[model samples]
Target: MAIWYTADTHFGHENIIPFSGRPFRSASHMDSALIENMWKVVKPEDTLWIVGDFAFGPAAKDMNWLEMIFGQLPGAEKHLVVGNHDGELSQLLPWDSVSQLTEVEDNGKCNVLCHYPMITWSGARKGALQIFGHVHNNWFGSRNAVNAGVDVWDYMPVTLADIERRARKLPINKHWTDVEQRTAAE
Candidate 1:
């Protein structure tokens, strides 16, 4: 099965439209577009790792609606990594696999996946790639890391091989805290 990664969908959360400067006119529109974009690449046999923030605000509390949405989406092996918004979901949702961290090995390379961007993770110095979300695109990741959130990837899931290829093209992040401070000030 093909593998994919994405995070911070925030489905059914209306405030995200304006707060994140999303182009959608409403949450429903955003949700439709996100689903369409996701299914375009993700097939039934694929595996999609939703790193975190699958839903938020009102959406997170609506168990029935959330489950319906999951059912409607293409049937891929769905894995979850808990994020700040995903705290409630981690305990209740019935997913293929759910955790705060997951490790993946592809093309002889290992990737450490998580919801929040970390300064250091398992195998950081050994050249393992860190795939994360929660910062969107404001904070550039470390040399061996990359943001896997939809906001940085045209609002759709990205493949591991693609993430690896792109990470290799970026320059190393010299000061992690400095980048955090700059993004906060913006």
Candidate 2:
């Protein structure tokens, strides 16, 4: 089974269409497109890593949308790193695991996974990669960090290898492990 990563889906958030300039005709269209496009890649045995912002709008109303969307996804297993939009109700959703942050490995490279980006992560100094979703495609906070949100990746989950290749092309200076401490000293 393969593994994939994605975030900032905002499934039922109608405002996202205009705000993000997505071409969907409506929230329903956007949600349907996302689900259909994702199934083209993901399968029943694949592991899907959703970084954050899976849904939005009223708590009770959105809950129903969340249930339907999650249940329809083809992935056999799913992991969630809660985003800003996720609430206490998120705990009620069915997923293999949920957390604010976690670590995952692809081949020989280790990656720090989170809903938001960070300047330095657990193994930043040693070349561990950072995979995040909150910034959408608007920003790439650090060199070693790659934004895995759908807005940046054609609205489908991407593989770890895809992230690693993109991360490798970022400016070398942006990945400096000491940037945080150096900024604080300044």
- Index of the highest-TM-score prediction: 2
Q: Taking the candidates one at a time, how many backbone clashes does each contain?
A: 0, 0
What is the Cα-based TM-score of model 1?
Answer: 0.87
List runs of model 1 lying over 4 Å from the truth: 89-91, 175-186
RMSD of 1: 6.3
- C-alpha lDDT values of all predictions: 0.80, 0.82
| Tens digit per residue, CA lDDT, model 2, 29-60 | 98899899889999889989889988876632
Tell me the TM-score of each prediction against the true structure: 0.87, 0.89
Model 2 pairs whose backbones collide: none
